[model samples]
Every structure is written in structure tokens, then in C-alpha cells.
Target: MIPWDLIKGGMRHHISEHMIICRPVSENTYFVLRLTLSYLSTQLTWEEM
Candidate 1:
């Protein structure tokens, strides 16, 4: 029989691992979106000038 504590610990570890993997991806996506938005804004301003 499996122990409840072991199952809980494994689930917790899995969740933490997923967060570790996803954290960088989400951060990179945010960074890219910010850069793209800034670039687009600059282009629009230049066209207006």
C-alpha cells in the first residue's frame, strides 16, 4: 500500500517542478511582448513625425 504522505509529497514536488519550468517561459513571453509593444509604438510615432 502506498503512503498518503509520499503521494502528497510527490504531487507537491511535481507542481513545484512545473512552476520552475514555466516561470522562465512566462517571463520570457512577457519580456518579448513588452519589447514588441515598444517597437510598435516607436514606429507609429516616427510615422506621425
Candidate 2:
């Protein structure tokens, strides 16, 4: 799982709601990251089972 603290720390240093929404590329990257994390967690769960 991606740590909220790490995400928040990165955001604190170099991102904002405005920047995230304003840039198309950044928005895509964010979505990809979300999807990848979700997929990874699901796979991990299946492996445990």
C-alpha cells in the first residue's frame, strides 16, 4: 500500500489540487498510480489466498 504520509509529504513539497487538475499529464499519472496500486493490492490478496 502506498503510504498516505509519503503521498502527503510529496504533495506538500511539490503539488496542489490546482496543479493536479490543471495539467492533463499529471492527472493521467495520478490515475495510473491509483489503478496500479489497486491492482497490486488485489493481486497480493489473491496470492495470500
Judging by lDDT against the true structure, name the best candidate. 1
- Residue-pair clashes, model 1: 0
Q: Give the Å error, residue 19, model 2.
A: 9.9
Task: Give the whole-model CA lDDT for all candidates, comma-separated.
Answer: 0.87, 0.83
Residue-wise C-alpha lDDT for candidate 2, range 1-49, written one tens digit per residue: 9799998988776756655667968777887899999999999999999
Every model's TM-score: 0.55, 0.54
Off by over 4 Å in 1: 1-22
Show the lowest summed lDDT stretch of 10 residues, model 1. 15-24
User: How far in Å is the alpha carbon of 28 misplaced in model 2?
Assistant: 0.4
Indicate the residue-level lDDT of 46 in model 2. Answer: 100
Residue 38 in candidate 2, Cα distance off native in Å: 0.4
Show pairs that collide, candidate 1: none
**Residue 49 of candidate 1: its Cα lDDT?**
100
* Model 1 lDDT per residue over 1-49, tens place: 8799999999999876875687878867777899999999999999999
